[model samples]
Target: MNKPIVAIVGRPNVGKSTLFNALAGQMISIVKDTPGVTRDRIYADIDWLNHQFTLIDTGGIEPDSSDIILSQMREQAQIAIDTADVIIFMTDVKQGLIDADAKVADMLRRSRKPVILVVNKVDNYNKMMADVFEFYNLGIGEPIAISAAQRSGLGDMLDKVTEHFASLKLEAEDDDRPRIAIVGKPNVGKSSIINKLTGESRVIVSNIAGTTRDAIDTDVKWNGREYVFIDTAGLRRKSKVKEEIEKYSIIRTVTAVERADVVVIVIDAIEGVTEQDAKIAGIAHENGKGVIIAVNKWDAIEKNDKTVYEYSNKVRQILSFMPYAEIMFISALTGQRLYKLFDMIDFVIENHSMRVETGILNEIMAEAVAMQQPPSDKGKRLKLFYITQVAVKPPTFVIFVNDKELMHFSYTRYIENKIREAFGFKGTPLRFIIRERKEK
Candidate 1:
């Protein structure tokens, strides 16, 4: 099932990142020294009160200095409307209400997406209750007081946030057919790909429908199987500014990947791989979507026997976080290897939802532990009690242990590699949930 999405929107210095860290249980946006790990924590998978949803930090991008504060805040609110099921419009009691706050609130109210107005930096609710009430003038909704720094009053705020989940159409996009999202940088032949596929003998299942958020969904049948393609192409260059374009590109990809079982990230062969490409690919990696890297405009580039090998190595190095992602060189113009692209998509989708038995998973864990002892710190070695698959759609696993703190990142990675060795979970990222035993 697809999880609901919640977005946080507010001006700078309203404690947006602090609140995001509090809800996510860690400092998620911190830049990691690891090579392939991206610093952009634009979105996170949140499990709160037995409720699962994806939380987006809408302020991840930068605000152009040339633009006024109101314009930037408006852009942020617009993003929340386009991508979120529930919007958390945060304000600072310290800063109080401003003209920008009221205007943004009006925008969110008109969008009709559930908006939860919150006032941050209210460490002393009793003392700051008066100041919090000032936020009611924004005319969005009742302002829930929260001190993200103190981490108090959050339960009340989250309760209000999750209440809207039941009413959201979380399952409205679900169907038996495999859903594929085509994502890439602008002008990477994204539109050409959809055009080529539909221009042929392939049957277009239905009329291209435009969603309320303005996303286009096309249904096509290939080889007697139906697939839904979410295309993030043909964006008008209204901004003209480079940063704003990148910001919008990421937003579109985030929403598209949320509904996809498999994602095809198209790349420009002439431009080769870039940092922006790595960032875009990381979105699919973070969402646990099955990934395939398609190098478009292949016919435009010079090639030799070693050209493919050289190109693949460069992509793997840059996108090292998703080494399992399938790589193929295709030409939307010449239709080179486009059929193989479909074959790879089929293989990836099958592996994406594949599940393994509990007995087999445990056996693999046992053998892996015997091969290399678990890491020990100050004589408290990590003890793995059980490992079992609790869900599919990337095959989530719950690993029970004596102490959660004893589980090291490297050790968890070791276990993950062992699982991969036994069963090839190619093109899909695996999620591991660590639970400590509640012993008396």
Candidate 2:
């Protein structure tokens, strides 16, 4: 689901990162006493009172500074304001109201987006209640006071923040067709593949123009089936992301991954698989989404009969962690072997949501245990009571055992292999949960 976005913006040392950590329930952004410490924007998922929203922490805004680093910080702050659905304009009661504070407030007001004024570092409400009112002169809105260090008055702050999301609906898989995200490094032919697939041969399903926050979700119908394709922003190395727009593109890519049912990790066949390619695959694998490694730009590579075979082997070696993912070779420019990609996407999505019967699962487990007994620890052999399938979409199972400590990682992996061998779980990851069986 695409969650609503809330961005926190203010001058340096106004506790924007502190309030961000408090709301996120973890320390995602670094908190320092020094100014300009946070040069990049940070994002986190926040859930409050049955509402889920994406929270963004931006670098401090110094409008008057023409220095290279401070100007970059101001640009980063502007990106947050442009992308967020709700803007949290924060102020420091300890610092009172300054010219920069009013300047920042005017910026938010001109955005026309819903703004919630926040007053931070109010350790004692009675002593600072009058001080909070001085912020009302900024003309943003009512200032809600809170101490991010002390973690007080956060409930009231969230109450006001979630009010903006009442009309926004979460992204749900209401249809049977699968949602696929095309992700890879910059110039890896991600955009080219989307253009080729949605051309004259394919039927364009939705004409909704995509906005910066929406990530350009394009729908196409293929051979009597339906699929939603999300074209994620191209990802670059941290050092190369010098501009403001480039940094926010990473966040858009993250959001695209979260909303996809299947992810196609595109790799440049000419360059072979890279560290950045492996990192992108890891993100999809960690999310438990069905993955397919699409080796793009095959037309550019000098090829022989054995070229495809050698390239596939190299991809497998680099992404050893994702053995379950299928690999395909194609050229997005000339449209060679692109039809087969649709079939692979369909296959992976079917297996991702597949379910197994309990009788079959137990039969497979019993056979596996009989073939190779689980390892013992000092004569304490593990006893398996039974096993049952618990979830789908990266198919999870729970096995009741006499002792949880006896279940080693290797044995669990062995069991997972057996299940896959019995029921083909192609293009998807499997999870196993071990729990102690209680005596009746």
Candidate 3:
């Protein structure tokens, strides 16, 4: 099943951020420089009750006065409604039923999307029960009380959130077409690449109806097989205001990356890779998606013999986490190396889902252990029992060990390198699960 997206929406100071941190257990934030960058909770991958979903926090800007809270709330609510399958509308029990909360509730009610009303900051449930009831009049749904600060009642809130997963009609699991996300900064020829791809005569799939501009994926027919491209760079903003254009770009990028099997991170060849490009590429890597660093507008940059090597080194240095990512200098404008994109895409997709047999995996494990003995502490050596493939698509492996704590990251890195040497899992990140087993 496709992982459903859940977004949190509410007025500022309504405990949205606190609840987001409480739920995600890790904070994801970005700070813009003098050019005015985005700073918010952004998005996180959350797993609750074995149900995995991408949780997006829609409130980035804080509105000071009560008069502007309505408009701000609307902005947050709209983004959530546009992207999320289920939304958690958080309210402050201390604030106690503001007019903006009621108005936003009406707006969400009209969208007809499933929403869970949450009342937060109820440190003492018995005393704050009355304040929680005040939110019921919003008419969205029953208000679930929580104390994000104390980390209480989150399970109930999450249970209500994951309950909606069964109803989510995601792109079917059996759809084998590799989902490639064309993501980059605000410019750098995202739309141009999308235009060129769309101009092709073979893209026969019809546009999806009734989806937000960000939600709809463009289908392209490449090599007689249909390929679904999640074009992040091709979005046309309704608000042309430069300052506000990037506000929701991260939200869209997160949404696109969440659903993508492979991420084509388009970068400006002229500008080379910037910090922002690294940030965007980091998203794909973090999500364990197959990545291809496409240097767009390759025609614009003046080339020398060392130009390609220099550019590749710079990108690798900036995005050092993904050394396995494939790099190609492409011109979406000239359609140079555009067709080759699909071939790389196919290769990476295979590697992303590639698996090895248990016997061979154990053989490699034994060889690796023989080559380098396991790390020891105070004469007690870490014992490696067995290793086997547990899953695919960023192929996950579980390593049974005598003591989980004894397994050092460097040792794990060594094992990963051994696996990579045996089989190239290029363009995809591999995940490992360490489990403790009693040595027989």
lDDT of 3 by residue, 165-252 (tens): 8877898877877788888876676656766777853222223211124545778886688888876622333444332445577777
lDDT of 2: 0.75
Runs of candidate 1 with Cα error greater than 4 angstroms are: 25-38, 61-67, 123-128, 200-214, 233-237, 358-388, 396-422, 431-440
Candidate 3: regions farther than 4 A off: 26-41, 65-68, 124-131, 200-213, 233-247
Name the 10 consecutive residues with the lowest summed lDDT in model 2: 203-212
Model 2 TM-score is: 0.79
Scored by Cα lDDT, where does model 1 land? 0.82
Writing each residue's lDDT as its tens digit, candidate 2 over 1-440 gives 46688888777777887787777665333323212213243566787878877787765333345444344444444655656788887789998987767766777788778889989999999999999999999998899998988988888988998998875555653765678999876667776688788884232223221122224667888998888898875322122333333345555555667778899998988888876566567657755789999999888989899988888888888787778899898998899999899999989988998999999888998999999998899999988879988887778899999899999988998999999898778899887899998655
Using all chains and alpha carbons, the TM-scores for the candidates as numbered come to: 0.82, 0.79, 0.88
Q: What's the number of clashes in each of the models?
A: 0, 0, 1
For residue 205, give model 3's deviation from the true position in Å. 20
Each prediction's whole-model lDDT (CA): 0.82, 0.75, 0.80
Candidate ranking (lDDT, best to worst): 1, 3, 2
lDDT of 1 by residue, 322-436 (tens): 8889999999889999878778989998888889999999999999999999988898888898999988778899999988998987799899999999988988888899999
Clashing pairs in 3: 32-37
| Candidate 2 Cα misplacement greater than 4 A, ranges | 1-12, 16-89, 96-115, 137-140, 163-166, 172-176, 200-214, 234-247, 375-381
